[model samples]
Target chain A: MTVNVLLLLVIAVTFGAGITLLLERSLTRIVVGTLLVGNAVNLVFLVASGAAGRAPIVDPDDPSPMSDPLPQALVLTAIVITLGVAGFLLAMAYRSQQLQGDDEVQDDIEDTLIMALAERDEASQSWEDDTGGEPDEEGADR
Target chain B: MTTHSAMSFLIPLPVVLSLLGAGICLALGHNARAQRVVGIVTLSVVVAIAAVLLAGAYRDGPQVVHVGGWPARLGIVLVADSLSALLLLTSAIVTLCVLVYSVGQGIVEFGPDTPLSVFYPTFLVLSAGVSNAFLSGDLFNLYVGFEVLLAASYVLITLGGTGPRVRAGSTYVVVSVLSSVVFLVALAGVYAATGTVNMADLSEKLQAVPSDVRTVLQLLLLTAFCIKAAVFPLSAWLPDSYPTAPAPVTAVFAGLLTKVGVYAIIRVQTILFPENHLTTLLLWGAAATMVIGILGAVAQSDIKRMLSFTLISHIGFMIFGIALASHLGLASAIFYTVHHITIQTTLFLVAGLIEIRGGSTALERLGGLAKAAPFLALMFFLPAMNLAGIPPLSGYFGKVGLAEAGIAAGGWLAYLVVAASIVTSLLTLYAIAKTWNRAFWRPPDPETAPPIGDWHPSTPETPQPTGDWPPSRSSPTGTKSGEPWAPTLTAVRQLPAAMVGPTVALVALSTAITLVAGPLFGIASRAATELGERTPYVTAVLEDGSGITR
Candidate 1:
């Protein structure tokens, strides 16, 4: 395949996987999507080395061509790293699901902020009610 | 010793020791005692190797070791220079302190079980990866190092699988993965353009490339690195994610991860692409990072969360030095990186101790800790003052050098850096002071204080019981919970010596750095000199002729 064609394909797959992962709330889908993106990136690296013609080992007796070994080596490392990361991510997801009984991440900050505001409002109302509806501003200032 | 043959094997020794350590840890996974012994022994050996490298760099200059005995252009090479040696030394020291700290904290946090067993091996692997990144002479190897460390971090961050941890870990994972992808894409592009990944070769070759294409590569790489470094606009994920991890994990991450990113950017800017355009961009980015990160710190109520923001902010100061691209600037940047790593980890560890004794990291939930835990308060104070760049601290020396470099680099942009750095320093002080006031000064509420006197001897409440341990029995101390001071005092008095020692050690290190600023500055200057002059690195790798082609 031509290098340009391979580049295009890698870009398409990577972006597709990225968008899919972003859209999904499920942790498993996200991990899978990350894997896809990682593979797509590896493909991009391979393609960038110029369309593969032969293996990188230089055989002096052979009449054929030599491929870029550097990119291949890099891609191999990247793949291993990605696999390790994916395994960890899966473990984390399982653990999360076990703890919360759901895979979806809880929006802790948003929830806490909203709850705190609501509690403050209730407390203010109760204070006013207890003080004969005077709505004491000094205590409410906080 | 001056000859290349003698120095080559020793150049990558630290990384080799660390990797070997990782292997041993993994192999003896079932034997917890053996794992701990191997892990600590290996790290100490690695530290010794780092010392050897530092001495070699000091004596004979920078050295490079090509992996698999290949020439520089064809094979992966690890370079040991003053800068690398300095960072390796700092990393080794911090990791050692953290390892010791983890032994104490891990038992409380993870129990004497499988989780802790799993943790040590991964931690060793992560340290090995970090050492590799510092020593690597090629860009591709650097990327692999980053991936290695990052993979280990993901496991460590979400170890217990608690709800908050999982949620935080997901964000951390996504952000880190995205950054790695971006980094990979950038690497591919650079390789496509240059046909070489060797740092020295790229330094020569990148100059021949067209300005526009170079800029594009520079910006792309910068974007990926900025995300990793948690710089300003890219830093929103850090505060949310970091506060949820186990304290030691957070401490290590805060200490090392972003610094690695900064280190990469520094390498690329000074060694590979010494263009004015990229440096100018870095300058502006540094300013913005400083402002935004401090602002985030100001907004946080949790001690760990606030420190996370401050970590991001301090990264700006390091970047500020690199952006100047002057001797003083680069030297100061290196100094700042080392200083920040020590100070930041110490601060996080102190924060962890606070969470352990006070029951929550949130400032609103803690108070009067100073009276109860004077040592902890002192521990927090040293790093806190150091972080604010108070006079006579290492932080102050680093900032002053950067400011001087900025002034020397004189322009409207330089002035902006000066103003921004000063402002950030002050704001950092403000945020830490807020933590001090609320978490340590204010009186605690008696009703909310954990009961101390009604001791149930059968069951000890784990310091942090979110997961991996049984729920803590309701407070044992019964004083009608009327007075908050007594229980606070009791907990303070009960603070373990194991925890207190590490904090004190870090404080002493910071103080020593401040006291001996001259030697530190000299070392930093040598590092900057070595980094700027790429000839030693290039020559060492390519001289053997095995590195010219793949």
Candidate 2:
């Protein structure tokens, strides 16, 4: 199964850029990242089919060693799915923007709550904090 | 010949009926009554169809159907082996119960003024996707099934488009998309290496692929599923996102979605990559997931959030069973998946009831639920105890099965995970007990007493004082978590019979799993045995006769 280096490079670059974008806080950039990654994966199907040949239409008389049609068919399905997901993601991004005036993902409230609880525990248990959250009553010792 | 045609007809009905039901529900959105009827009827029919298919698979062999009259090599196949049938039945039952609960609670209903008339259709669509995933014999079809369910879940998660929901939904959507993309890449790699995505074909074809490429494919596939299944490191998104959705949506997702991921893992490990080179790796993942996930559970102050962590923790048990890679291991894993699905969903539904009764799920804001509503408390108690794997329950049996498998496998890693699983179970009990004591057993906070009979639209309108429920007791500035901080409402009236009925039914079903644990485990072992054999599945799909050339 011979493969082209150029196609490989395209997949590599596109996937790399997409992943970098995906690490951002903003939902718009994440959507762009997802779209880019999706396209790169579609190209993966192409590369997987090896060096491209004639369009995959079966004909007895016109046998020109066509590329595997399966990957192409699969790519079509993948494209439609990606487009649908991208549309839904864009809608969500718009909604998030409307709700809070930005599309950046918020920190998990549960995590924040748990961290606060841990800090509160640390404060109460620590010997350094003589006040222990009651400054007037306990700080006189200090 | 008749039976063959019959199998084909029965195989597609679950997905087809649900989709048709969704379309009808959409068309009848203006008529909520008609829409509800269509949805309920459609799901009820599906449940029956699934049961019939399960009976057939158990009695006969794996039932294989090629869609659109295309032969196995060229077209999609839906195979109802024992495993798929069992899951199909369990999922069908759960989805229907959740729908009934949602309808009774009016959780998924969009009113005349509400712009989104999507709830019924989306719910049905979600069920359709679940059925499709369980039944799909082709890998790409499996992917499509995942997309369908995920797309529906995106709508359900943020149904109201509130600030918190949208925020949660954003994270969920992004994470799920990333996982799907990974799955697609793996699929591309798989096709590049082997020519087919059909599971049966892959079972044979994958053996010829180079070991390194196979390992890479295996890792990518596992990573994709791990994100979906919420295994340890990939699990941070779940507890963060799940508790934000409305209870019914969250319930259904907790019940069915991750199990689908686990099911996929079972398929990949047993069928595609039977060599099981990743046992140590998966065992480590299982141990870490159980310990870390439950630690997070123990740290949570909210009931729903606590359950979310427990859900993640328990996925570890199933993964452990898979890592064992024996008949007992696979059987126990399948059995455990079934048990967890029913118990987890039931617990979430009970959480919803508690929310309605107590007006908040936050432990600080809730107390005396047992005194206020003994029925609701009972509903919560059974599943909560069962989820914690108390003896004489289905959860306990499933755990015992896993521990036995672990002992039989007899590796240091297996022993470690088994110990970790027991500890995880205890931590789960601790979390559930804390929730029980704080939210149910303790007397209502002073601020909540002299209870006003407030009418919450989320519940049936109660006869009482029209005043605002309580005077503000917390700071004037609200917290970002949206937790009330102050005392919410105390239950002074009965929940609607409609709402209570479905929940009772679900609780009863969970209890029924215990009553029939012997037989269900029998079926699960049978399913696992069939899976172990492998030939039944491959031959059923491939040797259908009149098959197209590979």
lDDT of each: 0.78, 0.83
Tens-digit per-residue lDDT, B1-550, candidate 1 = 2256677687777777878888887788666567767878888888787888887887777777768876677778888888888889888888877877776665544444533446787788889889988888899889988988888888788765656767988988988998998899889888988999888889888988888889888888888888988887888788878887777789999999999998888888878887644677788889998999898787666788889989999999998998888899999999999999999999998887886666567665566788778878888998999999999899999999999999999999999989999999999988887677666765664444433333222333333434432222222132233334556455433555666677778879977889888988898898888777867766766675462453
**Candidate 2, B-chain TM:** 0.92
Give one digit per residue, the lDDT tens place, for model 2 in A1-142.
8878888899999999999999999999999999999999999998887767788888899967887888998899989989998998899899888878999998987688679868777421112312223333223433
Candidate 1 wrong stretches, greater than 4 Å = A6-10, A110-142, B107-115, B447-485, B491-493, B544-550
Number of colliding residue pairs in model 1 = 10
Q: How accurate is candidate 1 locally (lDDT)?
A: 0.78
Model number with the top DockQ: 2
Which run of 10 residues does model 2 chain B get worst, by summed lDDT? B467-476
Q: Write the per-residue lDDT of candidate 2 for residues B437-473, one digit (tens) a residue.
A: 7777666654543232232332222211221111111
